[model samples]
Target: MKRFLWILFLGVTFSSTAQRMVLKKGRVLDSIPVAHNATDNFGLYLPKNYDASQKWPVVFVCDMKGDGLNVLENYKTSAEKQGYIFISINNLTDTLSISKNVLIANRIIVGASAIFSINPSRVYVAGFEEGARFASILPVFIGNVDGVISCGSDIGSIEILDAKNPFHYIGIVGKGDFNYTNMLQTENVLNKLKFPNQLLTFEGGHDWPPAKKLEEALEIFSLSSMVKGNNPKDKSFIEASYNASWERINSLIYSLKMLEAEDLITQTESVYPRLVGLDSLKEKLRQLKKNKIYKTQKRDENAAFNKESLTRVDYAYYLEEDVNTYNFKNLGWWSYQMDELKKHSASPNAIESQMGERLMGFLNALIQENIGTLKKEDPIDEEGLRFLWMLKTITAPKEYSNYLKVISSSAKNDDFGTALFYTEELLKKGYTNKSELYDLKDTALLRITPEFNELVAQYLKGARYELPIE
Candidate 1:
């Protein structure tokens, strides 16, 4: 049999069992059986479009019920464009999908680094409803995951998403989805827990991801990185901007974790903290108390929806209380959208880019403040600024030329240490720190451009230190 999942991606992506995305196909490992008389299909999914020239980041998806590959199948092209490798653990039962998917996500990550050119630091987990539950509590299983994304899942009632590691997270759901109430609480819990994540709500429920939501999901996925450095500016603005981005990113992550806990697991095992947050919120934010309830509902504002089939979601069953699945039909609140949520956000990549750009942007704003201060004028509020130089950093025409100028100028001034720092920044693909060494050999500086000379000089100067690249 071709299996139930292949049909889900029918006519969309090819199903060549021989092709791979990130994992070796037909490679068996420690067994994870499904049920009596049925052996579990434990393997990897290496997308057909994957390229091997450079190391790739990995995204591990749990809840592969034959359709485990469906997530990556249609989206491999998009993911590959970002240089990411997608891996899925299939043959998961709906009942045990979370647990099994977690185990596989962890196992492949450990092996991926050794077997492939996978960046150990850039690993991530993703899931849906039940699958999302597994993705939500990921910190409980692995010590390091770059990011997470979940939809319609049961995020257990716990503070499993550790705040220290700084993982990225995002949640997507229909306002009236069958599990909508749980999804809302999931966000509340995340806000309390302070995980770095984002939330995007649509107008439908308990169904496969609608096409419109996919763009937001991809935006979150792209934002889940840890590249560092910021534009040079007066110190205070740089510090404040980076700090705010950290705060916002961390809160969103906590939100996504909670979303997963609600949909993926069999129980609401760790929701007490969320209760505490709501209690605290009532006192701090008066408007939030007005509703005293943010459970998922049936009414929708989404233009692409079927209102006749939708139902209203009103119960907060997955709160600091009980857990129940409105499985028989469309759960009341988990079926539709809120027609009036047209808030202005940036472009698709803006949220993702903001994580880093804001830091630089903040730095630049701070520079502006400092410049004004030097001119004997008023300064800018720290919170009012949010910007980043990621695209500008890449597109600047004088990027390399300026690098040489800065390094050459620093070196001629005899600032060896500063020169070394700049060259290394380029080596690490980091921006900000200017280098001083632009031209140096054992006997004389090279005739190359200042930027190239700086790096070459540094390498030869400390030929013993042995920097990467020739």
Candidate 2:
């Protein structure tokens, strides 16, 4: 008689006690159980060229909501481009304690290694926002992770950074992301620590980088591996990457992104010396800086950044006071401030435009922090939540969900005027979910009111429950 063991891979389960489970390559497996007895599932992807015979780099991704499949999808193309495996944990929700979430990520790491051909020298972690913060901290707790691709957030705790075992850190952030300044600051800190790191910026706000940028970040990982002798250096790849970097800098110079381009060249200067024939790159960089236009641009950018910083400080101070004192009367003043930021964002001056967006982005992060604190109150601070939510609707006006939150919170307080105002605001933002409006908790009486129904009918064409106006 022979002993038997079960192994599942890609919708197929095999019975073999002698061998570990082997997953199919090339496509995403939406839910692969950690083990038959385990409660959590993980999303996984293997390159089409993957073979059990060859060890491959693996990246573990985390989504705050535990949506492993969706998060894994973002890395699919990048994995294929870089010859890596991608896996995402499905049980690491924000509601869980940080310790628990870290443990969950570690379990997935161990479980995936057991089932796949993972390279011990090249394991990485990546995630967005809360997930990104979790990824940034994991290497501190788990020794196996060699690098992190943190998107839209910085490391949650600076105390955990181990100087002796610094990992390769790639931070991807949007120009308009709330985490933009933090990511830049993190990059500077990593530079001083002599840690291998790169900060990639895109053109949006507080979201995952596009697939192309993810691939670029992964390429940086591959290049770092080659530079460190973890992987054999290919002359063709080295030359292509170096040339691409030069081309980007040149493009930036042509487009009046002198400061950004100078920063990029400076950031990569240490790494490029490893590639042959790139010694002249530094000279080219010096020449770029000496250009009269570059000097002028740098001066203008400094002025804008400094002015924006002072304005942001003022906004932060008053917003906190307003939220704490429930100064609803100051709401009009906040509205005017948002409008001014928007106007600057649309200004013809590049520095002013960028500073404006950054100011707005910073405000979003500040308000969100206040909101998180209010929600964590033992008895629940409804007034604080309402104030922050109202501010959020003005600052992040495009976010329809904030408008919805305001409506629900206002209705709970029986502030029908506030509720009705936000109901119209939500609709104006193109929120057409009639059922969602009807289903909102604590909104029963408010939704049935003639004012609420009339607004709903005006925007969405009809309301589930309407009251006739006299």
**Each prediction's whole-model lDDT (CA):** 0.44, 0.82
Which candidate has the highest TM-score of all? 2
Instruction: Tell me the tens digit of each residue's lDDT in model 2 across 48-132.
Output: 8877788899988888876768767766888898888998888888888999998888888888898777888899999998899
Q: What TM-score against the true fold does each predicted structure earn?
A: 0.41, 0.89
RMSD of each: 24.9, 4.2
Q: Model 2 — TM-score against the truth?
A: 0.89
Which residue pairs collide in model 2, if any?
none
| Residue 429 miss distance in model 2 (angstroms) | 3.6
**How many angstroms is residue 53 displaced in model 2 relative to the true structure, after the best TM-score fit?**
1.7
Q: Model 1, range 1-470, lDDT digits (tens) per residue?
A: 21111111111123322222223322222222222213333334443444455556677776645666566665555554444566665655555555665665565566555555676566777778667776767767787776676776547545555556555566776544545445556667766777655566654545556654554454334433322211122345334433443354336434533222222221111221121123432332333223322122111212112321122112222210111221313212221111111111132322222222222222233334433443452463211111111111222322544344434545555555555554565445534322333233221343333544445555444331233466
Off by over 4 Å in 1: 1-49, 94-101, 224-470
